[model samples]
Target: MVEHSGGHVVPFTLVASAAQAGQRTDRFLADAIGTASRSRVKALMQAGSVRRNGTVLRDAADPVRPGQCYSVEFPPAVAARPQGEAIALSILHEDDSLIVLDKPPGLVVHPAPGNQAGTLVNALIGHCGDDLPGIGGERRPGIVHRLDKDTSGLMVVAKTEAALAALSADFAARRIERSYLGLCWGMLTPAAGAIEGAIGRDPRDRKRMAVVARGGKPALTHYRTLEILHGAVSLVACRLATGRTHQIRVHLSHQGHPLLGDPVYLRRVPGPARLLDDATRRAALDFPRQALHAQSLGFTHPATGAFIRFSSEPPADFHALKAQITANSGSA
Candidate 1:
């Protein structure tokens, strides 16, 4: 049977009949649920949303037992279409074909289940109105690339179908230039080098990305140490040769130089923290989000076929954190 309460699909119990015994649990649940697909049931099972006798069940291939009770909990549904909101924007360039803006930290670029409103998509819808082209769907924007919500950076949004097509092609062809500045916990041994790995979802932690040996997309990053502060942290510049979700963070972390204040990757206090004074250590530790900024972006203008580049300095908070570290470092 199905039950709903408080806008959530409450865990509903289902009993497998004798005829349904020995079926794959996912198949059985999918057939019994009626609305959810086998894939959906499998996903829920992987997420531990499906349980048998109150114990979480993760193996979708487990055989169903006759009269065994299973429970499934589905998360709340999100809005299909994001609505426009009058949020502020830091536009750098705007024209009929595209818009370039310095996206601030904490501003989500897309609407997702947890972040349904006040995203860059919502802001763009409000700013451009009907001028925004419907690229893949009415609900999506003409975003050819993306930045993590907490990673402030310059982003280009297409305003027309032609621009969207051209820019998407440019990104796919590796014709775009993107660079970032970040503060990491340790000095790079060589001061400059390249990181190449295949990035994919972490099997151990589904919500995070990792440099995996298999079933991942190849990603490369070139980096140089711009400065080393307190001999404890390094200010680094990175250039992306390929874009993958959390590629920079994952690659750097794999080298044991995880960006400071990266919640997902920086799980423990870096050993270099001991080199800093108490206050400097506190400043680094207190940083609320990843200390990375998209400093520069260059691309061929879709409508004009001219190379266009935009640059932005790190935000005030980023600079302030650096200043605090330097001040405590006793350096000139």
Candidate 2:
């Protein structure tokens, strides 16, 4: 019988496998777990879970050997609650129960293997000194939701155990409202529409997510065009009915209007000839990362049960990109 030792151990007995004989072990393992992301797979390898013939495989890039039986044990994740740092933060709201923050782009929410320090969690630890009422056995002190490193946005962090539980329940029940602003590659038609697609890890590349027809979680995103920039790009506002991993990025890309500057989803920049003009093309290229910003969040106060909301404007980078595009359109 094939020894796919299940549960915490992601083990596999390889014989008739298509993993390239010279491919990196991490990549091969990512391919093996069709629904797992490569970063996550790499993390598993780093945690000493990957094994080759009962030996711990330390190197992620170690080549796969044909016909070799390999096994992986996924250790239960331990959130290394980061040490407090003096990093500055833009606070929107703070009370005994929760703290709302306007997180800057490039600030990671929590610590993992490669991103060890200088995260928003570190700053929160400093700001909220010793008030963490711990959640879920892991050390992620009050963290409930996450925003990607490059996606600037607003987030709420829980302060006490009771608050954490209440906020978590709210999110799980879909009571929280999230709104985002995004710039995409083309002129998305109909002015407004809803995208209902299932999102899961891409079968071809585990490092990214995609809209898959099968074996994925249901996701819904509603979008309306806020503005059309030069007829080659658009500024869109999105509301999430269901939040799934990389849901907006995957759905928009699946719609053939991948977010501008999205490295993973955009794949290739729009050809210059396809764009409205040179300035618009350059605007697309110069925009550094996926142009996504979490603009607003609304929910009932975990403690008081009163509805409250907070809004934040885009940062300097986002504003400058929009200004340049708007200006260049007139010249063209």
Candidate 3:
């Protein structure tokens, strides 16, 4: 491996130690690089940026042999405080301490590669003016938690350092309450149950998350079937006891009922039409993204010492799909 110097992110040259040898490329990079996470390494690999002895590495699972030299190129990190964009925000509640947003689909929570501008953070920076810079670091501003780019939901943004610290503690302590609505591919036995699993990067596909029996962080999802769509699909309400990346998706997919329209965790139903009605089938097949939405959020106010709660309904596409599902099911 080539020797270089600097604490900042730059091209990295690393060798596979005996312990790292035979480890997956993504896993090895995550541990050896010290700065990148496994998911970030996977993104680098998927972007065709990681190379082994000058050869581009295509597979995240490519095993690194002992003494193998690999070079990885990472773009210089963007300076904090990306220019603010005047994107409209859906405000649920706002106060001096914090602001709650009913986040809409397609709005990224933060700036990242391929989405360096026009993120929720950018919008907040514009809306909050100078106050945001002091709330969180320059990079994330007020972000306390995040919803996926396509998952519409309620999310709280801190406006002050004190609020940020308090809200962060509440989230870590599991004092924040959150619930989601999702349509899945199949019925869950017992209609209501708790799914306890550990979520980690999928060994087979580092780009996705999975329920690993070991080595993953504990995640629990309590779900109740809200509506049954002809025994083929079910609408469910999910409450998370622990927040993890893609926790609900991984847990549901582990049990063989992946979320409908979820590109990453989809498990197509094997039987006849999961949706009997023609329109419903068409809508389900053409669904744009996962049918999951954060419908409820509750937490104690950091400044007021009062409990606050907020809720949002599914978006238009979600409603359309639900209507089609009901119409197709008839009475069943």
Candidate 4:
């Protein structure tokens, strides 16, 4: 959702009052007019969006002491040429505290590098308005967890402070369960297994994440083969025991079965497995991104303490890819 136009992101100011006492700068701004997420606020600050008495401010946790005047400005929506397209959203369930959405592939969970506008965050701002709390900062107001840009499926957005706090804690403690469906390069022989590794920045390529021994965080993924694919590929279901950056991708690739269109990890596909009909291969070779989906999300509601689960079918592209593979060789 990153808008590249020479658009103007507007700025606004807030005068501290008694009602806003003890609130952090990020939270106050999120609840203010235009309803931005905490992550958005962080982006604004990172993009030099906030100023305290004409001085640029950076940290979200910076105390909004009483009687201080703060100025915040966002790139105006209009200037970014942002059009509110009526995108259909699949709502699994809803309540005062949270929402579970079946996010589509290519829709980023929240704004980040190369994506700023037209994101789930911006759409939430348009839909939820002032309901989202300031947790992760302006750009990420209600987001408790994230799905990669090309991944599709269920994700939760918090609408209140209590929900935000509770959901955050659940994720931090690994109490919330998330599952995904992925198409990998080849059949996984054992069909059921666990991937345990430490992931960190690739010293050779900073843009990619790799299984590293040093300076990496522990990541665990448990996966089972849901179905065999054309004697070569496999449909796999994965569950996270520890959520780290690209945990599932790293784990699956480490097992020698990179996702079908995963550019970063599985760069070299063996000859026979490249199902593209020469011409189609040339076209698909230029396909923009990878294939991954966030198909399931489950957690205990922070406010109600009820176990909730949501699932979404893979998007059209995912189906199309599978269909192509099926045409190459009958289903397994």
Report how far off residue 240 is in candidate 3 (Å): 0.7
Cα lDDT of candidate 4 equals: 0.76
TM-scores for every candidate against the unseen true structure:
0.79, 0.75, 0.76, 0.71
Positional deviation of residue 53's Cα in model 3 after best superposition, in angstroms: 23
lDDT of 3 by residue, 1-332 (tens): 22335755557888787877788899888888887899989988888889898888969998887888888887655656766778999998998999998988889998887888889998998898977876778778888998999999899999999999999999999999999999887789889999998899999999999988788999999999999978767899999999999888889889888877888887554443544666667677668888899999999999989998999999988888877887785322
Candidate 2 — what's its lDDT? 0.81
Largest lDDT belongs to which candidate? 1
Weakest 10 consecutive residues of candidate 2 by summed lDDT: 1-10
* Candidate 4 residue spans exceeding 4 A from truth: 1-88, 133-136, 271-288, 329-332
RMSD of each: 4.4, 9.5, 7.9, 12.1
Worst window of 10 by summed lDDT in candidate 3 = 1-10
- The most accurate candidate by TM-score is 1
Candidate 1 per-residue lDDT, tens place, 214-321, comes to 999999999999999978899999999999999899999999999988999999999888888887898899899999999999999988889999999999989999
Candidate 4, 71-115: lDDT as tens digits: 877564542322233456777887888889888777876666567
Candidate 2 lDDT, 1-332, residue by residue in tens: 12334433345445425546888888887787676677877887778777788788779889888878787665444445567889999999999989899999889888776677798887888887765625433447789899988899899988888888888898988999999999887777778999999988899999999888899999999999999876767899999999898889999999888887787888876643164556656766867888999999998998898999999999888888877777774434
lDDT for model 3, on a 0 to 1 scale? 0.86
Give the whole-model CA lDDT for all candidates, comma-separated: 0.89, 0.81, 0.86, 0.76
Q: Could you tell me how far off, in angstroms, the CA of residue 105 lies in candidate 3 after the best superposition?
A: 0.9
